[model samples]
Each structure stands twice: as structure tokens, then as C-alpha cells.
Target: MDITEFEDLIDRLGEDLSLWPEDRRSSAEELLGHSADARALLESAHALRNALATPPVRAPAGLADRIVAAAKRRADPAEPHAEGETAGN
Candidate 1:
């Protein structure tokens, strides 16, 4: 498979080559053997998978509440603003 096809397969099938169909896995392995770019793309896909699997960092307490309050203030046209600010300013 070409590099473009390889990339599309990575997006569709994820970073795990073992889970790919036998035909596709063989073709992808062939491409990876000869193309440094393909190897690099596979490495990047693995890194992205590993990163996504990591536990997300916790947000600081009250951050979500502050965001919701800010959004509500912006959405409510009747809501009053501070002395120097307008609705969107």
C-alpha cells in the first residue's frame, strides 16, 4: 500500500497491526519495511495511541462551574455586565 493508504488504514484500524485483516497487515508490513516515512507514521500513531490511553489530568476544583457561569452570562442577553464592559466586550 502507498503512504496515503497506510495513513488511512492507521486512522481506520488504529495503531494495532495485529488486529488488521491478514491481507492488509502483510501489505502494510511490506510498505513499512521499505519506507522510512511509513515507519515514522506508524511510530507516531503508536505514540498517539499510548498518549490517549493515559489517564487525563484532573482539572482544578470549581473550573467547570466557572466556565458554565461565564457561558451562561454570555448567552443571556438580559444579563448585566460590569461597569466598563458590554455584552460581548
Candidate 2:
């Protein structure tokens, strides 16, 4: 399949593999040609997928408070911006 076709279902790949139901997987195996190049690509994608499943990097000290303070600063500039203000109104 082309990159565009694969992109549509790419994110669901790992989840779908768990529920492949055997028949669909068998068909995929056959269609993929089971060639060396395809096998290599599969291995690379598997490793990349595993890496993506890892937890996000932890923030450094005081980062959370800094973010909250920054958000407040942004909101402060919009003072008196009440519900009825209606933005452009």
C-alpha cells in the first residue's frame, strides 16, 4: 500500500494487531510478499512503535508552577473579558 493508504490506519496498527482475527493477518502476510525488504521495514516500524509507546519525558523542577503562572499572565491581559463580552463585540 502507498504511504497515504497506510497513514489512515497506521495509528491503529498496534491495537488492530491485537485483534487481527488470524484471517486478515494471513491475507496481509501474503499481500506483503514476505520479502527481505518488507521484513526489514516491518522490524523497523515495530521498534519505532514500541519506542512511541514509552511514557512522556518528565518535566524539570518547578515547571508545572511556571506553566500555571504563565497561563495566569496570559489570562490577565484579557481582563474584563466576561462571557457577554462576545470577543469581537
Candidate 3:
């Protein structure tokens, strides 16, 4: 397997090379053994996999209300004044 073939495998199977089809796995591993570029590709895939594996951060408390308030202010600037309050304050 060459760099292009290795990249195609990564794109198809993602960071987990074990998930690659059996026929392609050995050649992909061989490419990884012989090429620095292939190793870099694998490292990048690992980083991306790690990032995606992480849980999503929670929004700060009351953030949804704040966003809705902001959207409402944009949608109808006069509405807040009609209620004698600033939209986001």
C-alpha cells in the first residue's frame, strides 16, 4: 500500500485500523511501517478520533434563555420596550 491507498483506507475506516477490511489491513499496516507520512496520517486520525470521543461540553447555565432573548430582540426590537425591560439585561 502507498500513501494514497493508506489515506483512502483511513477515510473509509476512520482511525481504527482494526475496522479496515481484512484484505486491506495488512497492506495498510505495512505502509504505516515503511512511511513516515503514513504514520502522520494515522496520528492525525487518532487525534480526530480522540476529539470526537470526548463528550460535548455543557452550555453555561441560562445560556439557552440568553440566546432566545437575543434572538427575540433581533426579531422584534420593540417587544422588550413594550414590557418596560431591556431584551437581554
| Best candidate according to lDDT | 1
lDDT of 1 at 79: 87
Candidate 3, residues 1-89, lDDT tens digits: the string is 78998898788888787887888988888888889999999999999989988999999999999788777786886765535556565
After superposing candidate 3 on the true structure, give the runs of residues whose Cα lies further than 4 Å from its correct spot. Answer: 67-89
From the highest lDDT down, the ranking of the candidates is 1, 3, 2
For 1-89, candidate 1 gives per-residue lDDT tens digits of: 99999999999998799999999999999999999999999999999989999999999999999788778878887988657767866
lDDT of 2 by residue, 1-89 (tens): 43333333334564344455476555545545745654555566678878989999999999999688656655676755545544444
Can you give the lDDT of residue 25 in candidate 1? 99
Best candidate (score: TM-score): 3
TM-score, cand. 2 vs. native: 0.42
List the global CA lDDT of all models: 0.92, 0.57, 0.84
The superposed Cα distance between candidate 3 and the true structure at residue 65, in angstroms, equals 1.9
> How well does model 1 score by local distance difference test?
0.92
TM-score for each candidate, following the candidate numbering: 0.67, 0.42, 0.70
Q: Which has the better TM-score: candidate 1, or candidate 2?
A: 1
lDDT of 3: 0.84
Clashing pairs for model 3 are: none
For model 2, name the residue pairs that clash: none
